[model samples]
Target: MSTDDADHPLTRAELRARRAAEEAAAGVEAAAPEDSEPAEPSEAAAPRASTAADAPEAPQVPAVPTADEPVTRSAAPEQVFDDTPGPRRTPNAGSGTSASTADAAPAQAEAEFPDVAPAPAAAAATRVHQEDPPLVPDDAHVEEPPADPQLAPPTDPRLEPPEWQPHPTPAPVARRRRFPLVLGAVIGALVLVVAAFGVITLLQGPRVSSVKIDAQSAIDASGTRMIITASQPLAKVDPKQVSVSPKAPFTVDTSGRNLGIRFTVPLDDDTTYTVTVKDATGTDKQRQSTLQATFQTPKSTIFLLQRNADGDDTIFLTDLGGKNAVPVVQHEKIDDFRATADHLVVATEKGGTSVLLVMDRKGKNQRELKLPGPGFLSNLQVSERGNLVGYTFTDKGISATSGRASILVSQSLTGDGEPQIVTVGDKMPSIAQWAFVPDSSSALFIDFSGALYVEDRSDAKAKPTALGAAQTVEGISRGTYTAIVSRGNDLVELNLADGSEKPLAASTPDFGVPGTIAPFPGGTLRQVATRDATGLPTGQIVTRVDDDGKATKLFSVTGSDAIMQACPSPSGQYSAIVVAPKLVNNPYDQSLLPLPTTMQTHIVDTKTGKELVVLAGFDPSWCAQAPHR
Candidate 1:
């Protein structure tokens, strides 16, 4: 090689031509034997002008080492060849070949001399020459070489790796990105936990979630319902499993998740009652728990009537303390009055006839009720459950066969319809005394013929049930379906439901046979006459007789003060004793059901016989009807 060629390196075209010629000669020598003549060069082996499309095809070659495998070669003076394609070399001005034709030379040489081994030194020298400066000037514009079809296509721009940077994300930005994920995880966990707890609670026994009780209703009347709502639906509850503190009679009914406890009788006023149901369970019966509720009843108040012959008679509503007495109703002459849960029924005499006035508890809205005819009303009584008021009526002008005399009649408190005449065998018989059965529309009446009959006023088709002969129906026990009646010489308890008769037992500690018996829940209130050794009436004693024949002395009137009537409070907690102070001096009023003008009502506790209060009134609202003389 010349010095200029050695310094500047021969152009790639000249190098490739020289390498191809040497490989073609070596191939021809290897194909000929020692005794054979040298083979002539073929057109394919000789160097010629070629384009990329007209380049000679590559010969079949033996396996070569891959890019990753280590290659070894001998240190021989001969030229080295590589099977790997290299970068295309630009042709010099003296060479008549293009860059494409120069690129095809190496492939052609490798095909002709398939046994040629690669040299490390030559490969290093070729790489060094490739990195050197181009033979062309910097000012000249050179064309980019065309892509070789044998090589893989360039990688897609979209698939290229993104630009790298050393910037770390800001702390706040990283936290903001992760906040939603963390919150979602926590909220999901909380929801799952709450759902699990709710399922567990439902699988267990019923627990009382809430309770509702009408305190006013509980203290004022019987059959008041207290509802206990549970967390889940409950199983049936039996009455035997229920117990009430302070010992009030009650019936149990369970529906769905609500447990209803209906007090069969009124509860004591201003008292706290605890009701417990034992072995309460859920509908599945998987577990058992006790369901209990506590409620406080409100204080009770009562109404009393004061008849004044000189002025307007007044009906006063007062608490047991007798300090706060409010006049509720006033009329010229009030013969009898009865009070219900929300209303008052007052019987007043106008001219010579009776007028019935129904008013609210405050006596603001007064309305006249329709009567059977122009008659005198007596024995006014009210049934709170049936919303009815009953009375005995007698026509003002009454002859032997012309007018209605002491006939029993009942009507609605709203005065919507005419009074219904009570009948036996299609005839309106004269009733001597009648009383409403507690909590029902049925009436227990003693006709003038001395026959006791129970008739259901709610059903017009139902006939009266005759209960044989009875002197008088003293009183009926609430919820017991039993009535205390005076039969001949003995007092008997008549079962109004089944017509069964049993002698009324005398009070223990023997108060002697009572003159008047007033039946209430839990017991009866009796006004017994105290007699001297001479067998003469000396004084009056009001006694409480319990269900088990236990007797307690509640009140007494001695000397001149006389106890006209003894009545029990709704729950038997208190007794109202109507007394006339200075009996000889107290004159009788001119009303139909007249009492002494100077009458006083004494409120006494039945259990302890302690007198609560005394007020100037008679015929307390606690009594079902006016006292019969």
Candidate 2:
């Protein structure tokens, strides 16, 4: 509502009448523009012709003009007078009385004359003299000011909602989200495929069928050990039927599989050789099976040396080329012996045997010289320049059951001197392993009681002092500087320089790489073929013991066929391993075990730690050590 309307109230019907009247009066003025001329007025408003009379500006008129007067209607609407109207009539004042131009003429003439002309800003754009059919004062025309412009207010543009802004085109919304959705779907499918494949693989057992060698015979040097491994349970197969062959002649062995093979034999650097299985079957009538493999024999051994498990045997030499060997010693059990520049001292079991034999370089039987005890021989040592000889043996004139074990040292066997009978102790020393102390006149020995003792030769009466409880006592070899011992699960690396022990594993800890170590790495453990606790087929593993006393698995017994027996070969190049990978005797149709699968003797290479040849077991361990390759 406007302030002006709020101040004045009027009935709705009366206000509408007033609005109509205003519109009608405006219409009369708007219609005059088409028919207007500048009028030179003869003034009815002129003062009486003489100035003496008081000017009559506008005289009130009689509605019924004086009886003698006539009505004048000139170019004015007749509706202005009540007595004379065409369509509309003004209200009568009394009888026939009306208001007209005559009454308003004097005022109109003065206003129109305009003694002082109107300024341009205030003047009307179109002048109209058309008389308004003047309205008479009556109940119909009388009205009060309107009351309702107050209650309803005009709409305020400031509060309206903002106009919608139209872009030239819709936004590129779909492509923005498309790439990630596609990428996510592709990734999801890949993951599902991988998951399904894993499930399928698990459902099927170990998938091994056609075994082929991926390695070529040429190039690879650090010689590799050829091993035939089983993917499934081998209780159904026979090892005797299996025969190994090499395309190129080289040493092969199962010892590398049972005993962790050495890793230093480089195929490229060492001489090249290859071995494969031929007629891989066993000869035992009870069983028949065959398993075959071929690998490089990278390094060639100049001499393959080994001592029999029996205490009396000296070194047996075998040629890695699968040739025959000859026995070097026949009479006494020589536990230890060394070749000297002029002579060789041998620890022999009987006094008739020479304590030292002066042999030619060819190892021909030469002159004998006497010195120490005629007891079981153990280890032998020579000086760096070949001037001194150190050897150990069980004390003589004492019962083998007696606890007294003795060691002797001599500058020269012929030069008579008291044999340094360095008695160990009242306790009988059981030999497990032994080594000559480097740069000193003493020997380190590990007894079966797990005690490490050093026999000092400085004082003739000095007993062997205990280093500590050792896991294993290993026998020493020529040019082997230190003793590799094992405690329990760990290997005690005995430093020859100082009587110290460093623990190490017999195999690589990762179990991915094979190594000759003490407490070995456990996997498909290969042990020396033997019997298990249940009296079932088993094998022995030469695991080095740690000072902490732990056993790690190195290898386990695995034969393609039931193995009859396995013995270390003459040269240690190969062990007399008899087995079968394929078993021909079917229990469903058994006929004398289907004529035993072919069994063969295989020469094992100790360097690369593999077999050199696989043949029948007609060979003996008495062969020579160094056979020309």
Candidate 3:
């Protein structure tokens, strides 16, 4: 080779032409027999590319070494191959093997130094396609090396590696499983609906399974309550549809499946009341039924005290039925007495002091209660519950001229403690009248000046609550929510809860108002009234009045007969009317208080207006329900 050609190198086009000729020659040689010796090259093998010296320099190709011939390796430009094969071709100017392909230079450098990682397929592909120059032959002379007998011949184009081809996808799956899943869901939903309907069918009807009541007949001024339980859940109750005989004021409660009947007013004694609930529907509302019950209240009996002018006084027990009349006990100069279920409390005057006694129902086991001081007891009363006995007493002090003051006191009949003085603000008032609050340790009192107070006896030092002013305190009702009071000639019911007052009907102008009020069935009151036109009360009668001031006479007397006072039995079935000879003309107060020389007490059935019995007595009262009775 000439020196200029060696230093300037041949143009790329010349080099490429030489490489193509060499490759064609190799193909021809490879087609020859494997053992045949290679033929000598043509004269073209001689150096001839130096004529076009201004052409771009072509990349040098390193001589390939063979096992038999040790050919010297020239330092050639680095060439990098990619993992994914591209179109095969002889080395040319535009191939990524050249340094002129700037983007591929990094990959070629990495290939030259094996320690460096190869460029990724994506980077090599981008350079070859985007930044590569047009294809041109590389015409560098590459000295042939001696062939190695052990090496296999280059792979033929037709015998290239086979590419992977995807297997034919099976025909689209039939989706047979989806049908069964959808069908199962529908069947399950239908089963749930059927179960719900079956459950509803089983509970289609309403039926009353049992009935329970506090009493066959209401035994107290407080009415009775009845509870009815149904077999299944019931719908809302239409209260107006529930039937009650005698048309009394009542309320019905429907909670869950239980039905309740609350009589706001006491039911008539000795009367059969039928409560019928018809057209009652169950929760399912497929069927209706009628439920009914018949109950009768019990008749009432009272204890009468008869005081003799010259001898001992007697306490008698009698019933409105007139069959039961018996004398229980007797005391000398009996001033007042109260009957309880288990015992009888009596007060008698002895000299200047009053004696208090407790006895059993038959007048046996008489026990005297100790007094705080030598005093005379009056206004004696016993609590329905708690077995407490209370009274007002006037202590004469040490001498006749000593200041005489009245004090109120109470003690538990079952306890041994001395009677406690019912006081207001550390002192007892000179009470004109007082009554125990039913079923509680409380009492309502009115001073002589008509100042009403409610004192809780449980705590001795607790201040009493003032309940405004009143002429007289009749009684406490409905636990402590209501108070029956009389102001002048008008009777009023006071709601102690909110301090509201409601007028109660007065029977007649001549009667003023009965000291004793009998709350009967249908929210009606039966009370004693004067038969005469004079307000002084020449004669006596029993009248029934309603809330609107409508009055009806139930029983009456003629001539000079005077009804001193009337008391209703606990169940309101009967009334004990105390009658005395009229004192020509006199006010009702004088006749009711300070028992007359002799008085006749007649027990009469309020419903039938029939006198059951007549007994000689002064003070009459009914006993509360007791274990001994």
Candidate 4:
């Protein structure tokens, strides 16, 4: 070689080309017959001495001894070299040569000394080797250097070292490396979605989840509870915010996630009631929603007494439709009967005395309820709230100085104790007219001297409360403790709870003065006598006078038929009007409390003034006691 060529040091491409040529020659020698001796490397394949002097010191390879000497292997681990392409190392500033030139020097020296080839038996003894395992397992895939060295792609000198890094050691092949990474990403996404849903739920208003109510209790008595459950905790609700259709008196109570509504009076039967709560909000108060629910009440069942002068007097139970009449109790002479939630109390006359029989609603399981003494039972009534049956009693031969006379008495329906006699001060005065107050254990009565008193049967030792003189107690309202009583010619509303008095409000359009008034939940049923120009009786009008004094005519009898009595239902939705049709011909029965034999009761809707049905009975179960003459 020329001196100038030796001084210039070969480029990386030239060195790589020369190395490829020597490797091809060594492989050819290895493929030759085993018995043939290996050919000596050509002079052109030898590396220049100057190239070795400029290169970095490589790992020391044990020298192979000649055949004339004994061949021996070193105990040290085999030295390995990697040919896989990788990031170029930064060249040291002290070194005059570039990184590519230094890296090529070792390859050039190994190529020049082809005589140092490894023994054929040792497969791992190679100077240049691939770091990666073969991608395909087949003999046809074994790699070899190209036959023409110039065909290889040339490396650029300006190529930068890569920014990414690789593992220090080779890793085993994995068929499912991405499985764990994909699963982790899916789980993280689900957690984010769940968190978002929870935030939305908390920000919204509460929704009604469920509702519960008892239809029987709602129609039978007062204090029926309806529970409404919400999806989340609720805020407090004021009683004024709640409204019930077919309006009834109620109170509101609230707890966590539940709202309770208690009806203070019996609800109308066979009616659809809608309860609505306005501007109901959740505990967070983030949003507001109106809560509403609807439920229907069961139909009402009433019992009426039909008296027969010849045969047996019967007390039959019937529905408002006047159909399905079932005989509940029968006796030779039936005086009066009253119905409670679950049972019936009938006052029957046996021989010359009075007998009180208590039985189930279906008239089964009949049992006797003892009276205060062996006197007659006149006004029989029941107080459902106290479960007590009361009556006005008089001796068989009642006189001014004989047995007990017109004494008021009460007893438990369960027959657990003796009958209790009501008294005012220290005397059991003769009771003239009396009635049990609605939904209470108190009795509003007037003595023979027209003295009015309120006595609580539940409290035996307490003195009776006197509210001056009242001619008669027409009726007492259910939830409100107001009694419609007559004082002289004007009607007055007496507040039994506080003994306050106020004149009864006159109905609108001024329907004149009514003969009798029966107070109910929201109104009063007044029997107004419609007079003609001569100021004589013309017709009887049963008018419904509301608490606001608005009157609506329910039923009117203009002919010989007379409206004997007009009583309001427990809920005041309908009024039961007893009419003696053909009063001149309908003879009076020979009973203690005589009534026209051909009497028919007209069930009229108080609100719309619609007559529901005409039943062949005088006294309706809606009345607290039989109508007084």
Top lDDT prediction, candidate number:
1
lDDT of 2: 0.36
Q: Which lDDT tens digits does candidate 1 get at residues 1-629?
A: 22132234443323333333333333321111112122222222224222222224333332121111111111122222333355433223332211222223234334544445333333332232222211222222233233554431122223221221113447788899999999999999999999997988876678889999889988777889999999889899999989999898888899999999999898999999999989999888888999889999989899988887778999988999988999888888889988888898889888888999998999988999988888898888988988999988999889987999999998889888778998888799999888889988899899999998898887768788888998877889987889999889989988888888888886789988788889888788888889999999888998888889999888887888888888888888888888889989988888878778888888888889988888988899988877665
> What TM value does model 4 have?
0.67
Clashes of each: 0, 104, 8, 0
Cα RMSD to the true fold for all candidates: 15.7, 30.2, 22.5, 14.8
Give candidate 2's root-mean-square deviation (CA, Å): 30.2
- Best TM-score among the predictions, by candidate number: 1
Error of 3 at 611 (Å): 3.9
Question: Per-residue CA lDDT of candidate 4, range 289-349, in tens?
Answer: 8888889999987788888877998888888887799997878998788989888998887
Query: What's the ranking of the predictions by TM-score, best on top?
Result: 1, 4, 3, 2
The positional error of residue 617 in candidate 2, measured at the CA in angstroms, is 12
lDDT of 3 by residue, 3-98 (tens): 123344543332433333233324321111122122223222222122223333335653221111111112332222322233322333322212
Evaluate model 1: give its TM-score: 0.70
lDDT of 2 by residue, 173-266 (tens): 6666787999999999999999997665444422223333323222222233344443333232223333333222133333211211222222
Question: In model 1, what is the error at residue 621, expressed in angstroms?
Answer: 0.8
Model 3 clash pairs are 14-139, 15-138, 15-139, 15-140, 16-137, 16-138, 16-139, 217-297
TM-score of 3: 0.55
* C-alpha local distance difference test of each model: 0.73, 0.36, 0.58, 0.70
lDDT of 4 at 348: 83
lDDT of 1 at 39: 23
